[model samples]
Target: MTLKQQLTDDMKTAMRGGDKHRLGVIRLVLAAIKQREVDERIELDDAQTLAVLEKMLKQRKDSVSQYEAADRQDLADVERAEMTVIEAYLPAKLDDAELDALIAAAIAETGASGPRDMGKVVAAVKEKAAGRADMAVVSGKIKTRLAG
Candidate 1:
């Protein structure tokens, strides 16, 4: 089944199990997906769906950090819980070594050398590694590789 179908099925299961928190998160994801489809006038494939989930996960991470900085443990906990739910839908993330390997391959494939070629390298990396690796980490790796 497609990712979107799986999400819909999971939502139904959550409702049946009285899992309010999980259900709410699933609905939020579905709504976000729907909004994108409406706005773009295009159906989202699995890759696009994964991208949306990744975006939501990033937002939750940002919210968690902001909440913690403000000493709002309760709010932070909520964001953390939501993040956990969101993450469950994502594919397994790449570790640092694997991410680096992908980045090296991308740099080589693009013949990217020095800081001037950073954008080209990043675009290639994003095409290959989006949703699998953290872009911030990938960006840092690109900077280091270029600087060296």
Candidate 2:
């Protein structure tokens, strides 16, 4: 099944199982996906859906950080749980060493020379690693490579 269909089925399962937390997160994801479809007037493919899931996960990560900074452990816990749910829909992430190697290859392939080449390098990396790696980390590696 497609990722979107799987999510819908999961939502139904969560409801049947009376999983309130999981259901809430699933609903949020479904709503986000639906909103994007409505706004764009096109159905999202798996990659597009994964992009949306990644964005939601990133938002939860930021919320988790803010909640922790405010000493709101309860809120942070909720965000964390939501992250766990969202992450299940994403592909496995590349480890730092693996990510670095991929970035290095992209930089070389694109002949990225310095900070001016950061955009080119990022575009290449995104083509190869978008759903499999975090862009923030990829950009950091690119910056360090360019600086040195």
**Per-residue lDDT of 1-148 in model 1, one digit per residue for the tens?**
9999999999999999999999999999999999999999999999999999999999999999999999999999999999999898888888888888888998899998799999999999898887888988889889999999
Which candidate number has the best TM-score?
1
lDDT agreement of model 1 with the native: 0.93
Clashes of each: 0, 0
Model 1 residue-pair collision total: 0
CA shift at 106, candidate 1, in angstroms? 1.0
Report the C-alpha lDDT of model 2 over 1-148, residue by residue, as the tens digit. Answer: 9999999999999999999999999999999999999999999999899999999998999999999999999999989998999999999999988888888898889998889999999999898886999898888889999989
Model 1 ranges with Cα > 4 A deviation: none
Error of 1 at 86 (Å): 0.6
Worst 10 residues of 1 by lDDT: 128-137
